[model samples]
Target chain A: MAAPMKSVGSKLSVERPAFTTTSFQKKTRSKLVSIPGTRPSVQNGQLIVSTGVTSLDYLLGGGLAVGTLLLIEEDRYDSYSRMILKYFLAEGVVCRHELFVAAVQESPDDILQELPAPILDDIAIHKPVEQHGLPCGPQDSLDSMKIAWRYQNLPKVQSALASSSRFGHYYDVSKTMEPEIRQAANCHRFYFPEHPTQSSPTQSPMLESYSALLKSLQEVIHKGGFDGAAPMTKSRNILRIGLHSLGSALWGDDLCCRDNPRHSHALTTFLYGLRALLRSSLSVAVVTLPSHLIQNRALMGSITRLCDNAISLESFKGSERETNPLYKDYHGLLHVRQVPHLNCLVSELPDRKDLAFKLKRKQFSIERLHLPPDLSETVSRVSRGELAGAAMPGSACGSSTSGNKHLDF
Target chain B: MFTELNSILNITPDNFKQGEFVLISDRHTDGSFLIHHFLSFYLRARCKVCFLGLVQSFSHYCAVSQRLGVSLVQAKEKGQLIFLEGLKESLSVLIPKEPNTGSQALDFLRDPSAGLRSLYEFVRASVSHTGGVEGVEGVEGGVEEWGPPVLLVDDLSVLLSLGVSVGAALDFSHYCRATVCSQLQGSMVMLVRCEAEEEEDDGDEEGPERLLKGLTHQCSLTLQVQGLPTGYCRDIHGQVEVCWRNRHGNGQQMQKKLFQYKVHDKSASFFARGTSSAVL
Candidate 1:
């Protein structure tokens, strides 16, 4: 059966010798799997790579799979989602993968310059958690002595989420990635306002900016020799695409402008075409869409369905949650809208849905959402009892603050 | 081999569901598996099948079908299967090699107002032609001896994504029904994506919602696959709401049934609601 397929494939192509030999080598060698940054997922055996943020990768079932698109719904201010896009690109640079960055309002170069520098030393990588424990230094030991004698023998509750074998690196948000490190990787930039193929009056239903983006992505995939159908070159590499702030009015799309936008299918068509392009190539895209502004909820739903994975960032910058004492420890909530089920019937659902992310001084991390334990006596007895009951399993209430299990509780 | 699904769908070896329309719709969950089931089911039943695969490549369908105990390549070789690969054709439509020459099935890409006339023509030609390869052995030398043709569209919602208007899509399916179902006494199965959120907001209906509504009204059976309202799970993948319209008795009585399903690598199992092992 396999022999007949090989012969048929050879007969169809004029370059039969090269095609046959290359395909034979591809089957035997499977050399692409040996690429530096990629690893086959144990769950379904798909090639996966980091999303730059290790905690986020844990939420996304190892990482973004090759040839799949990850849709990031932008927060109200667009700050946190843009940070994620930068983390994705910065990870590509560290891994030496080729980069394709596109944006409408911001220049791709500007986005690249603001990427957080990756933390290198292992000691510094663990410093953020240790620093959180520094303020209670002198009193934590005393508080431990004051607890019941039987409970004193209990194991310390580690609060930090212990990540598995480190496939992704930690990034320090305060430091910008060095220009020298950023320039090490090959990068393609597409700023819509400055693109040469500005606005061609095409009969295609896709918006000019969107079609142009798709065409450019196609050229990058085919000409760069990332297409699976094309014969392999000397070396194979992954292409990381970072598209920022799509579906905003700046991209000539009106999905966010009105309740009944004129071009309702424009964004979805672009995504459809883009997904088709990505499926047959060695590329992964991280697209950040301003879904909050899009009035048509149904359109947003369709867009989410088109992409492989969809996540939305609901930051509490101006919302009532920002001022709530219960949520004081976190800056935003991360919703796992959709996870891809590729080559299998079931997807790898995240362990929990109530996940939150915070931007500490040195690092940004995502953690299972939890509220602080109420310590004051001013609270009523019934609510306090309830709070204690809810927080008992995972709480660092009496000041030990050391839970290293990533999914503690 | 999806025996459970077959029983729930009321499909039997001899019951070919002639002159009927089956609409498979999914929201926030993958419904392409239903397409695969119908594709392999018709081929196994010895019916002539025309599959309009607008989402994936030919090799993808062939690979999935091979696992389901059918050979699509062999089926195509024997003239039992007619496959239209929309992914490959759409690329050509986007970047036309020559000005006016291309696949007519995707003319809506080049001219949005042109609609799906050429696509419907393609389907009409495939199912009506009877002389190529004998789909069924001639028992009494009569055209009726041949097995009924089945038109399976992996998805019809993509046409809307490719700029084809909702009305054009409905018209395409309508004509397909007229030829494949009404005239030839064959069955037509189409897959569409419609998010359930549309029901909450009754103010304005979008393209997909309207297309789904239009197809649901015409179809004899409508199977809606949707994600769990609570979220993803380990045991049960999703639930299917099967609505059967009784065209014979007043055409207004609809039989609605719901079953939870879990899809495996090669086959899927259907169980009563809350009967999954995880629930136990």
Candidate 2:
């Protein structure tokens, strides 16, 4: 084992340490793991796992730190949230990490089948090497070829390297997930079926209570080797926990159901317990709650406060944005309500906090929104020579022909 | 075509950032004209646009684009313009015919869940075809790549009339907003029709009002379109009230401004109401 030496005078003195070289190396070095598509950030010596979506990882300041609880408030449709959950799970699968899916509505098998396939770019990486030979022709002299060789060795933009290393994969929604990979992945699924009416208060419950579910989840997580007590393995695997549609009608009653204080209390207790679990273990939990169902703003506020990060989706189809000519190309709006504070040393902090998101077939992106252009400027531009050609035809021809005809009639 | 409207909204192609959700609402049913005008603006600016026509037919939209001097066919050929047949699908659902009874067909037509899902699927397919998300990895030879495409929905209110629940419709809109406006770094424009008066007695108006409220709260910018009285002025076509809360501005306070617009043969102009005639 190679040991790091401390210099004594001009010569290096090989001082025998109390511990073994391997143990010393392990103690000194920070454990860093890479999550696909996102830059790995070290927080208190542990590597933060990537959220799977590159853009999202960028937004969250180099992916979510380990032991962080990310709360996603489900938008009206719940599709976007579901899509995000899939990306998270897919990322876990790709990294050979363990996943715990706490689903309330859909079965785990159905959800797994809908996972997006890993986008492979083997062709993209090989294309550049092939093209590198194209510039040198058979007719080229040795001197010219020598010059080309010199230029080729010069550092090119590292975008190709960057693209090749990107961990995010685009899953085709039309195709189902590959069963071989799905079976190979270490995924634990717990389905919490809703029980609308119970026969008796004293009788054994048909469905697991929120507290029982939280305890069972904790028990599973502890058994998954994420408790941080075991010796660091060469292959560090992250534990991803996803709670789909929490606080929805499927989860007993709505979180804001004041009439059922018992249910609401249980949910609050579960959230607190989940946060505690996240803080102690080498795991990340993504809990999605339907914002619309929780009418009580105070309760919503408390729930959001418990999580490290919170993002809510609001879909507005009102007349204001829908009818405006200026907004003719826009779809819906997105608001980044909260961002978790990172304690790590970051090179460049994400500047844009508030953003609007758009969903395409395979990709989702977030962008900083800007106000529409002033009306007076447009009118002025038309009057100026900028739009002179466009304005002349309308004013000179339309007035002369249509206005005169209208006046004549 | 959009100069007047763009000016009123304080947005120009150069300054308009990608991934903004702009809602255009018309009290009068002239939003189609505005949608056409904006599409022309995008096309003129050399921006790729995906038009989801939920209310108007694709041919009609194309004709309007042509009339506005936008080369729709060329744009389509160049992959700069894409049209999602939302209206066609919605019509198909409305006019379903099979061995099933009339009542059964009617029930299917009125089922908002299926219609909303199909609409969402149609939009996803169109966005994907345009290389919205999944195509980022495949960069070939040094050919000029298309920038993120702007998504334009003709009208979202049509989903409400198609028997979809307000919540589901709002959810779809939210999903679109989260995806197209936030994730794709693409601009999105959705048209919604607002009733001129609040009919408290009518239950039908309540859904639209709720939708309007929800959308208004989320949009960064909102332009209220209203047709001007016929005899008010020969030059002025209509009035638009622009309301927006500057995302970067202090305190998230909403700003409201009004402009009278005149749509001439080729160009449109927006002037401060008092100076409308003089500007024209």
Candidate 3:
């Protein structure tokens, strides 16, 4: 009966098939997750994670891209770079992301156990008062009204809370990490050279190689199901890989000291593979190297090239410039030699090119520098008086005669 | 004069960029006063700051900052300021009842790498939440926007005294620079003492001197502070020679300028040395 009714006017012919429109319409959904302090940015419809420091995310133009490798050239102190690595791993733990820590010098367990505890509680209690200044004046209330008005109309400032809440957590180094949180963290530690060598081997082939380490990392990443297409229902998790002191002797051999072609080749190959692995998956790796150890510039350059970002730290303690007054408050100097554009979608770039770092009891900060306040006015005043006196030495000497006359009376 | 200083440096939200390193060179004893000036400036600007007291105790720095007009206690309570006790770590070994014996303390002092590592970890954890989202939920209307964080290391030369090798110290400096430049997006002001190297050292060539040279080469900007020659000017405390290269512009051109500064009990002022002063 339905076919007979449609035969008169051919309703079926006029009606479009449901699949036709559905197939042509693109179902593009962008899922962006916030890393605590960074602006919410997406790359190819995926979210980027925070570097665990807001200022750093701002410097990075929006935190490290979802899948990129970050290489840090360690300062002689090595503590600062290691601290950064700790922040990376600690953040990973906080975000419930998978962490892979490869340590050459220290035990990975000790490093993990020593991971800083998040200062979320302190932040929660103090941030509101600190941010708004305790609603002291009528002007503040008036400003609040204006902000309310702005919040409704301005998209940039509308979701202030939403944006603020998306910031990373600060940790307390004095406090030990909670057992539950530490246990819940999806972390894997790889300590290179399972067994210590009793004596120096000219070429210990049995010792773990960079290639082997890379292979194991790849396998771990793959096994964790972080590779390939992300699930449709949830966003992809971030995978943080930390390579602590790569050029150090802990990673099989000191690539800096050894001229052996094999050692260099292994490092270069491992870096290449690691970079490739990072690109193909949703992961970020941070490698710390002591540039001082790497005597070969060409070798260091090559290593830097393999990574997406390269940063160098130099302390001024023994430098001729260390006596420079402007550096009086700094712990060290920092140079952002290179930052790769892994994602084409990000438009903002890091504002600073060179920075100084100061390490305090609780925090580390980098700042763009300007010449310290100029005191030319004071100098000029003094100099003007001196010049006037010098130009009229006779007059200056005679002027004292008048004062002496009064004293003589 | 405070406002004038602030304007000259332009350490405001608009001009101050995160990830900058500032090297402050001075006689070890004198720089602390100069550093207090910066601490007050940042704190006044509502910046979260961490002061690593390697040379002085936390209480001492706090007192100094307080005199400079920054209420360290209030700032600390607001979680906007933190004072890390670096001196304690090394001095702890000297305590009679402490677990670390004199030998261990000597060993720790001789090898500052371990202490530096722990200090680094502490700092990383302290500022991790800066601009973070954790406790922002209950914050009501009109949240004040804060400038980037600030870190002040009292004196870097302590590491040298602690027997941190020249290479290792240089490496540490490099690591600090990289960390701040790449991860913190904040500002660091490090104080280094420009003590004349002793002539008696035989094996190493003026270790501190060499280290200073290396740091100067790596730094973008170097400012050297020298006390006014004995009674050159009673009003002037010191002179600062600023050498900087604009990293953004050509990067080749280096600029040098000199400023004279006077420090009072609670305030400091800087003046450009007029040409007349040089002639005199």
Which window of ten consecutive residues has the lowest lDDT sum in model 2 chain A?
A1-10
lDDT of 2 at B165: 58
What would the per-residue lDDT of candidate 1 be over residues B96-174, giving only the tens digit for each residue? Answer: 4466666787777777888888888889888998744444333465333237889999878877766788888988898
User: Once model 1 is optimally superposed onto the true structure by TM-score, how far is the C-alpha of residue B271 displaced, in angstroms?
Assistant: 2.3
Better of 1 and 3 by lDDT: 1
Worst 10 residues of 3 chain A by lDDT: A1-10
List ranges where model 1 is wrong by over 4 Å: A1-32, A122-163, A198-201, A378-409, B13-15, B58-63, B71-79, B97-102, B134-147, B200-204, B229-234, B249-253
Per residue, candidate 2 scores C-alpha lDDT tens digits across B113-208 of 453665566555556555433333323532334566677887676545444556876777887777777877777788887654445664444445
- lDDT tens per residue, model 3, B1-280: 1554555555564466667677777641144555766777777866667777654445445545554666787777566777765544433232223344433322334234444554565566665665543123224633344556677777665555444556766776677666665576777777776552223454545334566677787776776777665433435656777776677778588888787776554565678774333334
Estimate the lDDT of model 1.
0.79
Residue lDDT tens for model 1, A327-390: 7889999988888856544567776678888888877778777777677877664455444444
lDDT of each: 0.79, 0.59, 0.59
**Off by more than 4 A, model 2:** A1-39, A42-46, A122-167, A170-174, A194-208, A233-235, A256-262, A316-330, A342-349, A370-409, B1-280
- Comparing 1 and 2 by DockQ, which wins? 1
Give the CAPRI class of candidate 2. Answer: incorrect
Deviation of model 2 at A330, angstroms: 4.5
